[model samples]
Target: MDEHYEKETFLLRIQAINKTFLENHQRAINIIAAMVAIIGFHVYAGFAIAHDFHKALPLFVLMLMTYAGLLYFLLVKQWLKKLEPILQLTADVFSRIWNFTLFDISICKVISVIIILAAFLVWIIIDSANSRIRLRSVGGMAMFLFFAFICSANPSKIKWRPVICAVLLQFIVGVIVLRWPAGNEAFRWFSEQVVTFLNYAMIGTAQTYGFASSPPEICGFSAVFIFSSLQIIIYFGAVVGVLYYLGIIEAILSRIAWLMQYTVGTTAAESLNAAACIFLGQTEAAILIEPALKTMTESEIHAVMAAGFACIAGSLFSAYIAFGACPTYLLSATVMSASVSLAMSKLLYPEIQESRQKDIGSFKFATSKFSVIVSIH
Candidate 1:
């Protein structure tokens, strides 16, 4: 009887643990939902205020909103720490169930299949709506496939779901940015703000370097003057560091990663790094996922590297703008590159090993590491 009683107690304990784990996971998800609500409110308020008041929102007000958002995100990240153990326990429980063999369908697989179908529907709808189907578009897709196949280290190991998701994502984003009026306007507004702010920083730059350093009137935009704009990269990097420290970037990136993971079966680190690469530089994004870097497979490493080569950082956006690139196009390309980079990497180095989620919290931001190491004799 004592043995039976002990067995009952053990089962009860397991149930209790599982319940707590699920509850904690739900709480974390709720917190993320609240954050999304707040983001929606802010975006709506910005648009409403701008349209109704017929005035651009004060930069200070935007700064305050960003600050508040960052604080909220930081608080949530701390709260998530309390749930990590529960999350791990939940994962452990799920892992134990893998041997049951009762069911074959996995949530990730189901979701990926659904996404594939939805993506196809979207493509068909768009194509049908278009005035004409261009042969060049078909040719371009063939070339992309051919490139992916040739670059793949092991063609047989390629994961089709992620590759398809990546291609569809890139297509959707490209069409929105390059074709949609509303999308163009929104990006244009953002680009204008970025340009205005960067130009404003030129005042401080001129003050520090002296206005006479290279008078554009005389030099006609000398290389020295053009290169001086690189100083803005430092200021932007500092601001980004603060944002990352506050957990705003992680919060936003994680949610994006969640969606991507659901659709493409990407691991948390890959999704987060991909999202982070959109805003931060490749080096910074790599640092953000450094904790998982060592454990990552060749495919994951390739994804990070591809993202870096494909997209420029937010800091460099202003520099590119100064170089006469269309701000909207540059922004569009970087955003699109986030997904394309992943697709390209997955094509070249298909993931043979299953990926596991990793903790994604604030990391040490060390810009000094970006500099080339040299040992002078």
Candidate 2:
């Protein structure tokens, strides 16, 4: 009986070892496959660029350096550990400088005003050199100022820091997208890629309808519009669902939310919702901060609502593209409006009461249940 028990234990141990070895072997195979695929892609790209070697040489070198840096950071732990003390010392020095305040608040405000005015003057000069000033430009500036003055619940309580920063951010983005050639080209390329990607929904639409021929026109518009809209929604919904499951959406929104919270002095919930409004519909964005909604102050609620009204939903990108809207302009407008909406909301309904949820770390994003594929449906 003892011999029989011993034999069973020995067999179990051998099976466990075999299972572990197989798992490790599979991992090794996967790693080798990935490396080979990457190398093959690089080789194909190299062949394609051989004709334009002179032009693509710098890019190739940069790519190599980037890969090298990534590998070094990922694979070399000892080097990172050796540099830890130096990194800590550098951080400490920067922290001390950041915490040091050399001037009084009133004096700092005056200095900031002077710097902003000077920067505005420089921007105007540069912009004038690029293109002639138009009536629309002046009108737009007037409209912004007029709205702020007209909407203020308490003019004295309004915070100008966020308002000024938001306006400056808009102007800077406009300069990049409109004034700079390289930046404009980059945005244009990105916009084209986005439109192309969204166009893929048409494939699913066609497949589902089993269309032998294009549909008849309705009210001078193709009936494809209806099908396209539904298909795009279904397609992008699944894409967003996958992104959410992989934490990509959360990772991106968190950084933007943190930036807004730091720069705009808004509560975590408000900033997060504002950031989310850039990619999601108002209802979906609000759902992200659902837990904090009931406890939110009136100003915070106003900001959230304003963001929803100001921004466009990501799902409708294809619809607008089909209508001949410039994708780059649409994307830029949504991004700029996020900060502007927050500023405008604050101006209209200034927050007098303290917020309960000030830190972004305290708010939890709503997650979908079950598998990602199941949630998409």
By TM-score, the best candidate is 2
- lDDT by residue for model 1 over 1-377, one digit each (tens)? 99999999999999999999888799888899999998987787777776765344554457587788778679977888899999899989876664334366566556656887787767756776765455467568769878888978999998777887887788778878877999888788777887776666567677777654346566465635443666677667766666665656666777787777766667778878888888887988898888778778878888888888888888787888877899998888888888877887888898887654443333232233323333223
lDDT of 2: 0.80
Stretches off by above 4 angstroms in model 2 are: 1-104, 129-136, 212-221, 372-377
Least accurate stretch of 10 residues (summed lDDT) in model 1? 363-372
Give each model a TM-score.
0.65, 0.74
> Per-residue lDDT tens digits of candidate 2, residues 167-272?
7777777878988999888788767767777778887677877552146665765655566676787777778878777887787798899998887778899999
**Candidate 1, superposed: residue stretches over 4 Å from native:** 1-55, 58-133, 212-214, 219-227, 354-377
lDDT per prediction? Answer: 0.75, 0.80
Tell me, by lDDT, which candidate is best.
2
How high a TM-score does candidate 2 get?
A: 0.74
lDDT of 1: 0.75
lDDT at 171 for candidate 1?
A: 77
